[model samples]
Target: MIRPSIPDRSDDPRVDVSLVVNGEKVMRPVSIRMLLSDFLRHELGLTGTHVGCEHGVCGCCTVHIDGKAGRSCLTLAVQANGAEIRTIESVAHQDGALHPIQQAFKECHALQCGFCTPGMVMNILARFEEEEKLDLSDSGIRDMLSGNLCRCTGYINIIAAVRRAAELLGRA
Candidate 1:
């Protein structure tokens, strides 16, 4: 019997990361310098977390780390070890039913080009989940969305979607 040769990667620096992703526990070996966004998208195949601005200025890579919204692009995979990470992929039901936030976005036409939709939804979802009372006023919504930048839709629809989502969540 012939034995297949396996390549050794011991010389390359890597760290074992363990975390709960989309309610499932996962463990993987990632490069020491790998960004959380890259780890999620490339290693875990969760591409919903977009990488827009590598500098983390754009909110295109927002995700829930330990139930708090954070920029995945700015976080290292090793730093997220033992943390709960939720990406946009976890928003919908297993049967493909859209979450209320996604429904609101669709009803209000919050997205154009759809590049920023995932991050926007994740950011808004975190706020809704964490806040006891949210300011639904236009200015208040603007304040909440200050971190995310959307070139399309001019934010008018996005703001409307936030309010609609709140109403759907019974938080309005």
Candidate 2:
């Protein structure tokens, strides 16, 4: 027998929200039940922030919230009111150039299928920023990316890419 899925309750209490996304302030009215991932993808049109597992286990929906890495799927948009959000699309350089991490990912062929690349890159960027003195060790890279699962490339390329990015950033 097949089970039926429950409908999303989108007609709940409405709330006014204002937050910084990709360095720009966005103000709008949203339902309290709206997930931050949906707000970024559907409302803000930032599809780079992917949603792999809606329950936040996959880490594919990772984003920067107030300078820390967080799972947008698990966070409510209303909770992000008055906060700062940074998606994968904003990680590029001011001149529209790829960020060092992104560049390394491309050069090292870190991704296949590309579904999990955005979240991996975003988490790496956030962690790199926080741990300013981080040295990209093999085990360390694996540990850092433990939350993100990629079914392609066997993760060797991803690790190599992160190491290359760290070298470029002078962190390795």
What is the C-alpha lDDT profile of model 2 across 50-79, one tens digit per residue? 887688888899999999999999999999
Q: What is the lDDT of residue 85 in candidate 1?
A: 96
- Residue ranges of candidate 1 with Cα displaced over 4 Å: 1-12
Which regions in candidate 2 have their CA more than 4 angstroms from the true location? 1-10
lDDT of 1 at 113: 90
RMSD per candidate (Å) reads 6.7, 3.0
Candidate 1, residue 155: the lDDT equals: 94
Worst 10 residues of 2 by lDDT: 1-10
**1-172, model 1: which lDDT tens digit per residue?**
2423324545769988999998999999977788899889878899999888878888999999999999999999999999999999999999999999999999999998998889999999999989999999999999999879887878999999999999898988
Report the Cα lDDT for residue 97, model 2. 94
